[model samples]
Target chain A: MTAGVTARTYMIVGAEPEWWYRDLVSCLQATFGTVLARAGVDPLSVLGAGWRFLHLPGDVRSEEFYYPCPADESGQIDLGSALAPHHQLHSRWWQPADENDVWREVRETLADNRLVIAAVDNFHLPFRPAYGDVHAAHLVVVYGLDETRGVVYVSDAMPPAFRGAVPIEEFLRSWGSANPSDVQDAFFSDSQIGRRCLDVRLDAPPAPLTPELLGSYLRTDVEAFTTATSTRTGLAGFDAFAAELVERCRAGDADALRELYPFGWGMQAQASLHGELLRRCGRQWNDPALAGAGRAVEAVAHAWTGLRFTGAHGLEDPRAAAADIAHHATVLRGKYARAVDAVGTTAARL
Target chain B: MTGIAMSSVKAGLCDPVDISGHRNNTAISAATETKAGAFNVWGNSFAAEYLPAGGSLVHVDGVPFEFPPVCDGPDNIRAAGQFIGVTPGRYDWIHVLAASERRCEDTIELSFADGSVDAEPLRISDFWAAPAWFGEVKAFESLVMHYPHHVQRGVPAMMWAQRVPVTRRAELTGILMPRNVALHVFAVTLQRHGQLA
Candidate 1:
């Protein structure tokens, strides 16, 4: 490091990053939504275009943005591909190259006029309701870095949304926090922030969503759900996941319930967005069948509340909660089946 | 939050049901005793200051409700298959002031005195700074959320007014709340059959 070298300042030119959010989504989708919106694309059209159920064993993390992203044979995972199966969006996780200059990657990304999705700890961020009270791993978009002013510009679209400069010291603490486990937040704590950041790119602008295009998308998703694979995906995968979850709960394994909260959140959020998009499309096109199918899919999302919350409250007694857990799992599975059938039938006609 | 008023309904068509025996959860707390409320798993609750007085009569869209006792003790009933028996009557709508740990859509069993039972949808939106996703009327809100240790500002808690239809023409004798632990019912009112209640 050269002595007396002035630190560079960078900020994405244009309006502040827009806060794109839905009630059901976590920070993962919210941050991605903001980035996609900045690229002149409707966040929902991209994020909600495809939906599938995938659960990788031991892949769940105690982070709000945790979503299962399987790696290829080459050991590389593309979160963007996992999120938008039908789009040219891609993302990669990266960390600061030099520990001495923790803000290097952020500066470079901001200089390139790209927004960075950085992992953070809620306990350290003043704007967070959990600030200094609870430790929870979360994600937020970083739009600018001002070394000269000693503040880092940040934006979060979640509840009590905040956008503005944060003291560099505070931001760093949150970004690099160990995020020790707090009893208050069993689902999102105990995960390390590790100064991680997600670099997202929309390789191509999405085409207008025509009826035919949506039909094709629905058909593909329907096929994915109906076709059975060795992976934990689709109806068969959900069956396996649910059975195993119930078994573990019966065995009094609390970890099963813990994982269920975060893992179910990802699935729940996806179902909600997909259903909302389909319903909107249906209404706009005046297609009652499609709208009905969307409602079915939304029922799957709503059913998740029962299962996830049951598991959440049952963390204290997995064995006692097993029956209720199994009940909700069965209910949710039925919803998935019905929604899949409805979507398939509607897609066939579309 | 104001409700959409339905015209042409009789002035005294609503009857506030007594659910005092079913109050099993404390969801509201004064700023001084935030720890007393545990609305969600996180021990968060609604601030008493922003709510109607305990045991007060509150109205939304001309539907009267006997708001449960606040801060004093259990103020809401966490749904767990509790069978709430009502006066046998031919009601058009069963209105409830409810909230859920998250946006939930479950079913409640409506038992008629004619020995027939029907399952009706009971949908409630998340109370954690969320919108009324189920098209429920926003009945009450705590401007600030109360955590066990402190009063958290900027995050508000919500209570919704949602209803389930008594589709059957027979008298409704009892309502079996779903076994779902996510739902919480604070108050209930029965609107007589007629005029868009």
Candidate 2:
């Protein structure tokens, strides 16, 4: 460890990389927490799960220059300026034109302060032009570099699969030759990973991804749908069918409404269909206003379906319209039940 | 967007071609490259060579389909127009053909809307899988139908899914984990039956 290296270096090296994109973001958040803790900043307040960071812009296909400080007196981070010592000391490196520039900027950044971070490119195994041809790119932290061993230790977001130090020269050459289109972004740090050269930890065991932890990574969209459906259905257990119906409606299934008309006479009938499910589940319609709005929408759909099916001639028969609306509503409810059940089964593991 | 909505109006069959016996024959070998901005539809196998922008050579129910100058030539075939305009509506009775077979007896009903195509009654026959590579070949001996959608939003811009019987082996292989399956479906709607301007 160097004089400026913090105790948190070993901690970051041990963490697992998350699989999903959101989980990956969470991993970044965790890293920031460690960084803030070392800086004597309250991790909770300054760096938590959803903290936003300043995004450095870069084009992978083009060799662009980046500067640490703002070109103007504003002292902002100017991406175009050359890398400097003070900038490097901050603990992270911005994207530079080439490997030579990355090395030079990293050295300067580290000299100013041990806090700097640099973004480095990690090459994958069995590389091919096809793999390099895509627009996807990965970001990793440069923890250390050993000149003699010719290795650059990286804290990759793609953990287990791509964590640890790689041959410095070979890594750079592979990175440089990568289809420029695939060069996404890099991370640099004046922290231990950036300055202290260490051996790539290939043998270091990976952290487990328990089911409980995986549940935490559930998609927000799925969660929102679940919550809404549960509230609307009021069923003690989640009604997969009703949820599917709502999803189909949200998906703009006009025929679904038409099919629902016959089962429910009017908007009130439709509301009851949703309301009864919720009531059976021991849930209350939390918002009366929303409940009223839902009824009104259902009424419009019921009336439209009736008119279309009965034709203008049949429009004179109010009974026929009512019967048609009820039939349609029943069909919609049936379809909703089936879809919800399927979706529930499919997503049950989550 | 408005034109897309208006263009949702379906056109009648200009020249209906039979598409039987094209699947599993490998009679046509064409290279398809997807590009940004405009879709490109080109193949080595074609009766008459016709080029169209914003279109790609797609495989539907084990059969390959070329758009614009539909089929192989300069006859001003405009079936690709279905994929051009938007407004997400279903179209019935979509068809495709290969260059090698002229019998054209193969018929498939394709319902397309919202950038996805579903080919029903088709089954997977054989597949190729190894380490990082995965590929599958599906064979549909019986009746084949297609339902496609032109997704302006949500998921893939263009998608096609087919169901076929397992008469033969389906082969699939790739390096990276395959994230998605690309299905070739048109995004045009049928406003009127057999009416094309």
Candidate 3:
């Protein structure tokens, strides 16, 4: 019997069915990384460093040709000229053909380790009008096939909707219909497609710390901030903490200075606070003082109070605060570096 | 253009000779005229002004009150101050105020110019106290009156002609005189029932 891999088990875990394409992508990348590692497969080697799904055009082409211009290819095929022959291909995935055949082709494409991306034309589903167009669909891995259900369980680059598990029938319909004049219905003949499949064992989803994903994890914090509970003071306490740090820096406190360094609390706070300050200050951040102050507060708040306190401060998400800190830290660090460089240059000249 | 100086003084009031008699004060009684609509007490009493001698009606404040050349007769001049009589029904009197100079402070008193005791001398103080008087009465109410002007320019100036509700007719006891300075006052009395003899 195969050892139970956590990543593989998580692949079957039910998720919000109606996740967006981007959300699914992020989840796949995250899950696949851990899963592949646990499966004894080097994720880096299989997935490649900085591996990303390339977007495909949602149009019909004159001919089928592998993308990234395969080294052995006879130059680039002009889409307008190739449209006729490409349409004549007997691939089941190409519509005006059988749906089951299309599914088989898609499955084969996934198994090939080639990235299969479908540009959904008029991507909105009939049941869910809000999903709008599935501009891009990237299949990262095929987990398994539900023979009884006739459904393919696949990891996608797109975020899963709240009602996860996109129906194979529905996905095919969208994928087949997205035929633009310049490109094919979906990316089938790409060199990268079916090139390398990673034998990754997926892991349990990580607790999302970023603001966008914070909603899934920190419901209470979001509610507290939205309702404006006095308990959740938002960056006010963080501001105070930052001020103390600044004071310590002014006073030449080695410990405080060390805390402010770009490593642990200081770096985290700076990144988180910078994001928060950028949002709050918006265009007002043209002034250095206002922007700096916003960043300082963001950093201090996140460092002293794990984003859980964001709820206490009437803030729905700590991720926003974290983002602010990060942005502010970056800006301040750049300025500080410049200042230091100027001072060093002057000293060297003297 | 030639400078035509207009001046007028009551028989009992001080008068300088050789002054052009362009200044004329006319009054219209409200007793016979029917009130056409609801007591629009706040409407402008002085709808238009006209100087028969043709020069702009230069207000004492240096602001010019544009009076079109439409007033061809004395009746139109009398109708200029006809707004005071605008009660819900026919009124026994219509107190009309006229400014003779441009700065707003030169007092104009209408009296029996011929020294005929038949015409009563209307006191300026009496006109100032009546509810039907023009302009704001309460010192503090004036501040409220200014609020609308602060909201927009020219609004308060237009609101200056609104009517006040008062029971008594104001009476002036002196001769009518138009000083070189502008004067804003209400002229009040019982309207004449028939044609004056």
Candidate 4:
């Protein structure tokens, strides 16, 4: 330990962070769910409330937890806002203020009784299935840092769900790894785990999701989708993105397919959650149209599987894969348009 | 019930179509030779020990299926729009032993002898530690997942017994698989329209 570093432990007062997960979501949503659960919030209700499509070309990162994050006017990226636009949820990425004392920030965050979302390479975490086999960047919730015991309390909800203590040395290696390229995992590798962590806070308790409240949120999201912005967003933005992706593949650019897998996951997971939430609300309120709209959104999520896997298997031959890529993209675009229409009609009634 | 009454209500009236000719993907592997199977882009496979033996007849939910060859060679059709011919007979259902790299929903074209074609939905859940989202019967499950380099525990590989309806009361001639590369079909069976007879 350093000179002023105390050989002590810090942890939250309540129970361990709950593991919240859906089959279609990635670690990005899973870790965020754990934090929200600790804050006395239903993970799905908030995470599944607002949904929109935003694809940033040349801005995709090779990480399992990568999501399209846009910076505000002051150049500060708030991932919480991007993920949950309907609520007062806010998040900002931070690193250790002192390179020499890397645990300083983690200790302070734990002491404040809040969870820390740490970025790490699965290759180094023993609990991860990719440990010593593949290199992929992922996220996990950190609930405790027992420097005295030389173990960090970690919780992950992704497949092969794991929670418990990890040795400090191994956690450090994973958290600070330079996740290099691996042939086995073409999509979620080649990204650096630069000890990045997300500090998320829900400033206000989410309002009970009544029909009126949900209708307003849906109207706002529907507007975002119908309106064209400077950035790649909404229905028009999706058209622009899909066209360029097919063009790049046809031109024999392999990088285009490489970026599609990670980028599509965020959009897919969002649609699935949003769809599930709508279906639940619909069933409770005896509104078949709302439930059907949820199913339409889910079809959008399902359609992404074809496009993503086609691009993945076609990585070896981009030109040859262009036809199938275009076919799936067209199919996905149709699903998106249909889903938007359904949600719009349902929203007006609500 | 009389003998005649018992004989009239017969079950197991399904023909297991031989799809050996269309097997193009090796998705099952023994723990010792995990490198041979490449089910997904990550080169993962189902553990052979936990699955039915090679070339066995397995019954799932009253439907019989001829299990594909296990460690010998490719055990599933990695759906690439292959067309499988069936005996021109009236059928009520098309049962399949299927799994996908992820939760997938696609369409399959059913061709009839009368030259009519219909597209039916083929939904399969993810094989990697995921539930059957489309309410498919869990036909077979490998307790462990076989990676190219090692056998991973706690992550089960699942194969679903899903069926598509042959709603058209016509003699089915052929079935056209989807162009999706993520969907895999191990075995298929055509159940005769016994109730109609």
**Cα RMSD to the true fold for all candidates:** 2.8, 21.1, 32.0, 2.8
Tell me how far the alpha carbon of residue A194 in candidate 3 is from the true structure, in angstroms, after superposition: 15
Q: Residues A116-192, candidate 4, lDDT per residue (tens digit)?
A: 99999999999988999999999999988888889998999997999899999999999999999999888888998
lDDT of 3 by residue, B31-139 (tens): 2221211111111122222122222342221112222222232221211121221112212232332321111211223333233222322212111112212232221
Evaluate model 2 with DockQ and give the value: 0.02
Give one digit per residue, the lDDT tens place, for model 4 in B29-134.
9899999999999999999999999999988877789999999989999999999999999999999999999899999999999999999999999999999899
Model 2 CAPRI rating: incorrect
Docking class of 4: medium
lDDT of each: 0.92, 0.27, 0.27, 0.92
Runs of candidate 2 with Cα error greater than 4 angstroms are A1-13, A16-74, A78-138, A143-148, A155-161, A174-350, B1-197
lDDT of 2 by residue, A1-350 (tens): 23224321221223332222111122232333334344444333221111000111121111111111223474433321111111111222244545455565444433333322332222332221122222222234454555556665554332222446666665565344432332121111111122221111112221232333222321221243344442232121224433443454555544333333222222222222232222222223253432333232223222222222322112234343344334333543443343334323323443
Candidate 3 Cα misplacement greater than 4 A, ranges:
A1-100, A105-142, A157-164, A179-350, B1-197
**What TM-score fits each model?**
0.97, 0.27, 0.22, 0.97
lDDT of 3 at B196: 20
Each model's fraction of native contacts: 0.74, 0.00, 0.00, 0.70
Report the C-alpha lDDT of model 3 over A1-350, residue by residue, as the tens digit.
Answer: 11213312222332312212210112323334334443444332222111011112222221112211111264433321111111111111222235344445444443443222233322333222213422222223444434445444544332222223556665555445433331211222121221212222122323222333222212322222124223212233233444444444444443332222212222232233233423343234243443343333333322222211111221223333343333333333343333223222322222
Error of 1 at A45 (Å): 0.6
lDDT of 4 at B21: 99
Give the C-alpha interface root-mean-square deviation per candidate.
0.9, 21.5, 33.9, 0.7
